[model samples]
Target: MSIIIIGAGEVGYNVARKLSQERKDIIVIDKDEEKVERVAETLDVQAIHGSGSSISVLKEAGIERAEILIAATNSDEVNMVSCLVAGVQAIVPVKIARIRDPEYASNEKILGKEKLDIDLVINTDQEMVNSLLRILDIPGARDVVDFAEGRIRIASFMVEPGNPVAGKSLAELRKDYSNLELVVVAIYRDHRVIIPRGKDRLKERDLVYVLGESAAISQFLASFRDRKGVAPPTKVMIFGGGNVSLLLAKALEERGVATKVIEPDIERCQYLAQQLDKAIVLKGDFTSHDLLEEEHVREMDAFIALTEDEDRNILLALLAKTMGARRVIASINRVSFAPLAYQTGVDVVVSPPLLAVNRILQYIRKGKILNVAILPEEQAEVIETVAMETSDIIERPLKDLKLPSGILIGAILREGQVIIPRGESVILPGDKVTLVASSAAIPQLEKFLMVKLEYW
Candidate 1:
């Protein structure tokens, strides 16, 4: 599809780079000639200089030929107006607007597709918050990817020396917990994605990926938990009150998780205290070891560092890890700091640019089927698809069905029992089947599972 992206910022450039790799024709527009020229020179894309919201600028970029128009300028007004203009004048089939203002996000009537001309709205803050909380669920997991309406998940965690999973093999695990239905896909051992065979044993510091029902993943996690009471609703300790922290704290509280925020700014802390009830807000410098210790950092099930200063967040997250926090997550906006954060004791590292890239990628692919969600770290993809009544999936049992390789049907939420399929399992109309596919087959994953129905 011919794509035109506005704003030659890092987020815009990253989106163009990713889409260009897929061989899409991309054109980027930016007011600053320097950024436009720099991005065009570095990436395989066209550069158009002008304010993206201007009608003349849209026309010059061949918006009429563009299948998708993305307005991602930092300003919410620019993004919304640019997309509206593209929708009304350029006849673009899909228009995605990057909204930065948090207030506009809550006004669903204004941002909703039915009310606004925009087809999609991207919110990086909300996406990052979701990622932060998700990474905390599995104590040692560096990454978490949810599928099947969040019912099935794939998580990757490092097995340290004292970890329970460090000395176990898949076969032994199955023999010991025969009722549990979880599959280990790959292990990052000796710097490679080792396809674990039945005899392959988990070792210390090995990063392993496991796929299973959400409950099964929880059960598996329970085995490794240091001491389990009634599984606490993720007690989280955050080290900043920046936009990311505020958004994350609100999201956590909404999910019934306890959030404790430590910020040095008294005014921000007071604001947070007024805005959030489920979260405990504190005004103190988390960098001070005494302050962190007094706040009971070691008792926190999960610790996140989301301050604007990447160095501070990284340093504090590492400190929390050293102080015996089970999970440590840090938000590093700079790509350079990403490697360092991961190398340090921080368990999970999230980069805004990467999250923005994934969001834009989803916005561009609108014609295939129903909803699409790409898993973090490019590990997996979860798509909600409707199986056609005439499709082969309806006639034969799943075992007899010649399903695509590297793809497994995790669950069939047909009228809601969440059936973990057996050999005789069959798909019917209105049945929502959750599938897990490895990275290699993600592009063609949906093709093998559902037949896209089109109207005349």
Candidate 2:
């Protein structure tokens, strides 16, 4: 199957890189020669320096043979036009666009099946805000992803030295906390990801991903928190007046939280003030340490840096943490900057591009694949998929299935009940199973799901 990706920007580049690694036929189109060159040099895919919305360029990129077309340009108009042109020129089965404009996103008729026929519309800003809210809901979690309609959650937490589960093996933890309904799926330590086993030990500063029912996950996470009890942030100070910050402020306001936004641009601040009813908008430079101090940054329950500047966001987040803010979240656009930001003591790093890529992957992997959540740095993914009758995984106990090394069955949703799988657990056809697989093991996983040939 041929896939045509428009725009060689972060989102487009990431999607192309992933698909190319999976050995899919990918062709990238970008008007910018430099970005097109970068994609051609780095990825084993065809790159064309041409406008995505141009009919000639679509033909040059072989859109007629493309099974999937992804429009990820920064301009909403360009993205929409690319999809329309693809629909007109080819029988592309799926067209996904990254739409940022609220006006276009709110109007279903404009992008409906009768109109644009877009298979999936990704709103990066809204997805980022929702991800932030989920992280905020779980106070100490580094990342949180919901599956099975929020019944199952894959939450990542940093294992502190003093935490109860810090130095314990998964087997010991299972014996100690026998009633807890959570399973350790993956562990990230020293920039390496480990598909954890029963004997694997969780170390300090290790980012551990656990999967289970919502309540069980909460009970499991409680062990990572201190006795003082971490409460949800009641007061949030956002350091940008962009669309994402505005949306997040509005959501927080609905939850009755005191939200404040500081922006350097006076006009933007004025616009934000007019748009927001309860959230306070202040016109000031985020670089001014005195201004932040004057606003009692030390007393804030959470400090968020959502500015366009990645360096500024990381530095401000670190400064906020140093100023005694309870939690600091930074919006990083570059995937390479996340580990460094985390090393600098930033509580959480949210990447909009990565979030967009994750959403797009869900649609690209058709039938039986219900959802996909890509872990940080593309180290791993937690996939929620249904067991198909034609697959070899069903009607047998999990242990006898001869699963690959870097894959773990996190949870099984049968009928309405959630099951934490064990060696004796059997997977039936039509059951929703969540699997955590390392990046190296994804091909094996696709083979097991019997979607290897279908994916291409």
Q: All candidates: CA RMSD in angstroms?
A: 3.7, 2.0
- Reference-based TM-score, model 2: 0.95
Cα lDDT computed for each candidate against the true fold: 0.73, 0.88
Candidate 1 lDDT at 20 equals 72
lDDT of 2 by residue, 43-131 (tens): 99999999999999999989888899999999999999999989999889999999998889877898999999998899999999999
For candidate 2, list the clashing residue pairs, or say none.
none
- Predicted structure with the largest lDDT when compared to the true one: 2
Using TM-score, give the best candidate's number. Answer: 2
Q: How many backbone clashes does candidate 1 have?
A: 0
lDDT of 2 at 316: 95
